[model samples]
Target: MNDLDIRCAAPSDIAAVLRFWREAAEGTSITDDHEGVARLISRDPEALLLAEQDGRITGTVIAGYDGWRCSAYRLAVHPDRRRQGIATALMDAAERRFLALGGRRIDAMVLESNERAHRTWGSAGYHREGHWRRWVKSVRP
Candidate 1:
């Protein structure tokens, strides 16, 4: 919508953001809970971006940078808001943030089973790295 407001997540917004993810996001992360998200906002402050329309969150994306790498996670849009350029607006904001921070490239994590997300990422100019596979070891149980 034309009234969409894109901004950083505030401490007050954690609860609503968690709820929004549960409703709009495709998959869950181990750190999807309150404490984890709170920690992120505390540490990076501006890494979590939200798109709101009339005070309700319509989409979200986490544009994280660890000094060297620019990574994107949790790019999600509300079901009712799909095909409305919300995701594109979010990515455009995220990429601008990364570029402003001197980031050369951004890597996005997309679920292999999520075909819709694959299409979305591809449309955003992200390509799969078929030569590499992700390896993960949870530091916390």
Candidate 2:
């Protein structure tokens, strides 16, 4: 294993990222497509971070800071690459990004059924807030 390189995603990496998600990520999102990801990179170039080792992408995390709030999404690591500190590195990068942007706190979206993710997040010092429930509506125009 080589030193992992964490950097913001570029447009050229979209296809590879989508495919990586299908294999590594637990769930899908409305903005999983190329256009949607492109829009994200265009709007906030530093939001999507990719972890690469020896030129292959091993992990990813979306560290989005909308000036007021810091939101973490799509924290994924290749199945073959799990338990190898890839996720920890990604989270460390995301947290650093948030702190640099003056973000006081971070909210991560993890699936209820994803026990693996829960453990991962918890080990990273994140606690699930039972008081707040997420209410979402799929609004596709």
Tell how far residue 40 is off in model 1, in angstroms: 0.5
TM-scores vs. true structure, each candidate: 0.97, 0.96
- Model 1, span 1-141: residue lDDT tens: 689899999999999999999999987888999999999999999999999999999999999999899999999999999999999999999999999999998989999999999999999899999998989866785
Lowest lDDT 10-residue stretch of candidate 1: 132-141
How many residue pairs in model 1 have overlapping backbones? 0
Error in Å for residue 8 of model 2: 0.5
Q: Which residue pairs does candidate 2 place in steric collision?
A: none
TM-score of 1: 0.97
Question: Poorest 10 consecutive residues of model 2 by lDDT?
Answer: 132-141
Error of 2 at 78 (Å): 0.1
What lDDT does each candidate get? 0.95, 0.94
Q: Whose TM-score is greatest here?
A: 1
